[model samples]
Target: MTLTTLKQRSLLGLKDLSKDEIVSLLDRAAHWEAQPVKVNPVLQGKFVANMFFENSTRTRFSFEVAEKRLGTEVLNFSAAVSSVQKGESIYDTVRTLESMGIDAGVIRLKPIGVLADLATRIKVPLINAGDGNNEHPTQALLDIYTMRKQFGELKGLTVAIIGDILHSRVARSNLWALQKLGVNVRFCAPPNMVATELDAAYISIEEALKADVIMMLRVQLERHENGMIKSAEEYREQYGLTVERAKRIAPHAIIMHPAPINRNVEIDDELVEHPQSRIFPQMENGVPVRMAVIERALG
Candidate 1:
């Protein structure tokens, strides 16, 4: 199908996307990466709204950049500043944005199925930045883009994802995206750190070590009770990736991390500097990958 078919489309998860759609996005991204392309000014007269209910650094800025680069104006709406804090229901808030003729909306929400509910009534395309621990489709797309660039290909590769799987949208998105792209994925966490729903035979960190890539996620201590980590040292002992662990992987295997790493919590400092580490590149690629998503969503 043509990229135009994706027009006014909402990207909420990778599971619903076909391989062709995924490749089309990557192909388009390749063109953007190789050249400086301007957003067709046709959209200059249009508007895109960002409705972020939570605090963010990358997702929020990336959407703004993508929309502006596409020649569209963006209006940022945060809960702290919006009427939602004053008891405005999501139904009323979305209707308000719609009344102003929003061309499209990108939402980072909390309640599960909130987007589904909003989509039923909203007239514009809606992209889900994140919804609780559900999914972060854009983040997953960027992640795959980073991995493809780093390893040159994703198929036939083994990838290990270590850390708090239960609370990580990054991990959930990565698992689905990588698996769909034909990469083997494994998880490693202290028993309780991982989600109960994460059960797969190939899901062991040890088995995935035979992999060509290792992606690490940071622990979400803020989401836990008891205020602080009971013992940071104990948490690391069973799950932290040390220099010695790095030596056991394939020579071609790469290391990755979704940013804001916990240093000694989920990974060793020495492993961060290894030649095989692709964490920095992953972080850097966030801009262009996001640019690609915006271009496709609003192009």
Candidate 2:
């Protein structure tokens, strides 16, 4: 499909996308990836703002790289040093930035549904980098792109997303995108960490390992105030992808993690660098996927 036919104006969540739109976007990403340098001047001379309210490593940097590679000038906004610390509202901050002539804004905030609200109030296209326990659309896009690169197809594939389902934007985005693309998604987490509201089937960790792909989610410690997990070791013993449990996984099954991984807690140290692990490749794929997203939004 041509870029002219792309339908999305802002990427709030994968839930707002159709299967075809997702596929087309991924195909565009593949086109970007196939090029030798992956540089596109589609967004040349435009200014994009990186407005992050929450701490991030992968999502923040990758979006910056994507913007630069696409030839767009980037304006970095730090909530820590900005007037946001002085109780400045999101609308005020965004509007102030928009008044300075930014073409689009990529935001990562800690509050859920804030992106949707901001999308309505902002004139520039808004890309949701992440929102609290809500959705991470670009992360899911790169994840699915990485899976497609590994397996060549997503049809009939079983993707078991294990751990911290109650507070994962990545898992929520993955479910919407993967399910729409004909993949069977299962959620496995301890009783306390599971979000019972989602319609996915619940399965044990052992059962999850048997799937075509296994995605380990990081346990969000910041959100756990009263200690839902007894200890890291106990959590690992039960649900972590330890060396012993990794051996039990199907030979063809691949492992994935949206990182800032908890090392030995969510996955064994050895298993993280294992041959079957797609952790780093997923990080690499983020650039092109985000390049596609930024280009589509502001190209």
Candidate 3:
């Protein structure tokens, strides 16, 4: 129940965490966010690595910033420039880093289950930034933090996650985290994009609009094969959060999207900055949440 209890825990996914542990991390994040600007130096003597096998904007930069802010020395690992490009195995790569005396690692890879496997081999704690379509624990943590900041509690809130469910690590992590906190969750997506293993209610987009939180997922075009979506315009008509559709959402409902938004594709550009949208704040919350994660992993 304390930071000491979280020491050396590898955050592979939200499914591996208890509701109390999740809430404790969020509470620590809030504490960090509320502190005055000063050098806390909580992680000054530690060294952490950011090993990203996939391209990222928010997760990559946020973790780096969080590490720097906490006074931890950061090693940025680029798979493109490393032996991974030459067909080196993940075990070898992680072992190589661990040999360098890295205290902990934040990994984002493109293959599902790789993080879990690598965590077993590495001596240092491995925090999953993302692993294929498997899970993104920190993103879900920041998301819940953002929602809790808005509603002051997570219990009894209904969350409808829309769009590319099959390829969304964010969706997977959020489902586990939210369900544990007593949130009602619904999934709305094109039939092909829905992961049947999720065990959530399949609802119409209109039905989803009625939830307390409407999370729009970015359509992962890179992961989709041909014919997954007929066309962007058609996908928008059926699933995109258009201006008209946005109007019908509950007045108190909050809109959320994990970024690199395709503008008019997943969500209307105008609606992104709307008062009810928590997208930006979600990004802002990433830093403090990650700070808590790194500190806990290495503290």
TM-score for each candidate, following the candidate numbering = 0.87, 0.96, 0.96
lDDT of 2 by residue, 26-135 (tens): 99989888878756677899999999988887789999999999999999998988999999988899999999999889999998777787776777788999999999
Give the lDDT of residue 128 in candidate 2. Answer: 90
* Local distance difference test, candidate 2: 0.90
- Point out the higher-scoring one by TM-score: 1 or 3: 3
How well does candidate 3 score on lDDT at residue 219?
84
**Residue-level lDDT tens digits of model 3 in 257-297:** 98879888889989999999999999999999998988789
- What are the runs in model 2 whose C-alpha is more than 4 Å off? 1-7, 222-225
**Better-scoring candidate (lDDT), 2 or 3:** 2
lDDT of each: 0.74, 0.90, 0.89
Q: Which parts of model 1 are misplaced by more than 4 Å?
A: 1-8, 37-42, 196-199, 202-208, 223-229, 270-274
Report the alpha-carbon TM-score of model 2 versus the true structure: 0.96
Question: Best lDDT goes to which candidate?
Answer: 2
Q: Which sequence of candidate numbers ranks them by lDDT, best first?
A: 2, 3, 1
> What number of clashing residue pairs does each candidate have, in the order they appear?
0, 0, 0
Model 3 residue 119 CA deviation in Å? 1.2
Which ranking of candidates, highest TM-score first?
Answer: 2, 3, 1
- Candidate 1 lDDT over residue span 131-186, tens digit each: 88888888787778877887677797777777777777888887877787888777
RMSD (Å) of each candidate, 1 decimal: 3.2, 2.6, 2.4
